[model samples]
Target: MNTLLKRQLLRGLLLAACLPGVAMAASIQALNYSSREVDYIAVENPGNTNSGGGGDSIRPYGQGGSICCFSVPEKWHADLKVVVVYQLSPDPTFHRETVSVPQYPDGKSGDIWLIVYEDGSVGAVVSLYGPSRPEWPGKIKGYPVPTKEYRDERRKEKIKREKAVLHSMENALDGDVSDLTPVELMRLKGAIEYSKKLINILEENDK
Candidate 1:
């Protein structure tokens, strides 16, 4: 499964436990039931390829097998199972790398990242070494961080999503208000108002 879907499933499972007035006994019962239902699907490695092949940056290099990491679902920590399917290379030396995987907080995808090279040395990097963001792993003590590209990209995406939501609300509002039912109109109006509030907060934070 892809990262996003894995997160959604985990979040849903967690929400059920964190709800208000959930008694300890009730929570345990629910958790036990949920644990039995959760299962892990091994990620399929993207086929090996060369750097010159296709996947520009994020895409797996053609020469190396792709590694996708996933977190265990909440409540299933005791029964968590990890399965890896090995792909053999033409040369024995170009074999799959064995990684020491760590248990990540349930639901985060890729807490364990595998590094594969055509030369056959496989290494595993834990995101814990870095901050919550994997792209910005922990600093090298006093060494300066070369760039903030990842943070900038995150800001850009937040802006993009906000704009899209605002645009959609505006379009909905521009449609016939006369024909709109009271509930539908209220929903659209609330969305527009929420978008305005979000924009204001973002602008304030930017300043």
Candidate 2:
């Protein structure tokens, strides 16, 4: 080949070789270890369309399903950073921060995880494994721990549900059942009894 053509071919080959290191699109997921729900969380590299993924309303101590199409380099770089934007429960404001992406444990990229910590801090990790795996490389290992505030909120919700059930059952029993079948009346009475027992148990526990 001519000198110009040879150089052109070499340049194309080099570009191809470097493409994987430059950027590769991958899915992103959020794991919430915080007591409060994650109203929304997004991860992106500024000015780069290839790197953007987000999910909405990840419950406290819950894992969000993966979102598509975010760039993750095949190799980690010291200067690599991503902008994480998130909102938590009881806070109307959105929090933004630029966090460095931790290196992959084995130096190979897979899915990207955005972890929401108890203190509302955000962290980034690139790994082929989920947090459930022993090989996962997150700073906080294991599943989320529910906070006291979360536990209380859950208890209140449960009580509310139980109260609603009790109310409905009571109303059904009070209504005219002259035309009702025997089986239906018996079933309703059984449900009322169970509801009473459950509510009593819950009330005793609260005390």
Candidate 3:
């Protein structure tokens, strides 16, 4: 083969090899509409961990940033399925569910959305658009709305954390601090005051 022809053939082969990887890559995003915070979400094909992706905690009524590079076929197939494994906050157990991949319209590929519902059921949809877009396929519309239960739980957790901080600060103040530099002593006193103020605010809100 001539040099130019040989170069052209080599380039064509490289393009062919690269195309499939580009086509197969996709991202996973979580939309937590549930009353509980989502601790984590992992998406994989049944018994196949190599080709999947996952993301960390998303607060109730919040959307998680995208986690990249899960495999999705360029062409949609009827038999396609992904296993979703996730956990909700305050719940020690992890849940797993097998979900069928929805068909993409017009052969379009998009990110996989894992929807966590208020009733604790999880659903998956493949969409090129996010919840803000009209093309979104999830049943609930717009951003998630936190239920009363969720709000109450959040408040309680916040108060608990603040109380712990106040207790720690109080204990430190009670200890011998004669060795602390004047600047350090002032900062410590300021932190204790801040902690007291936060605890007071949380307590008032609880009433």
Best by lDDT: 2
lDDT on C-alpha atoms for all candidate structures = 0.38, 0.77, 0.75
Better of 1 and 2 by lDDT: 2
Over all chains combined, what TM-score does candidate 2 have?
Answer: 0.76
TM-scores of the models, in the given order? 0.34, 0.76, 0.66
Question: Deviation in angstroms for 1 in model 2?
Answer: 45
Which RMSD values do the candidates have, in order?
A: 16.9, 8.9, 8.2
Model 2 residue 28 CA deviation in Å: 0.6
Model 1, 1-207: lDDT tens digits are: 876545534543454356442211110000000101111112212242210111111112211223222332333233333323233332232233334434443323333333333333333333333333445322222212223453455566787799898998798688768988999899889988988888777766555
For model 1, give the 10-residue run with minimal summed lDDT. Answer: 26-35
Off by over 4 Å in 1: 1-122, 125-148
Candidate 3 structure, TM-score to reference? 0.66
lDDT of 2 at 153: 76
Clashes of each: 7, 0, 0
At residue 102, what lDDT does model 3 achieve? 75
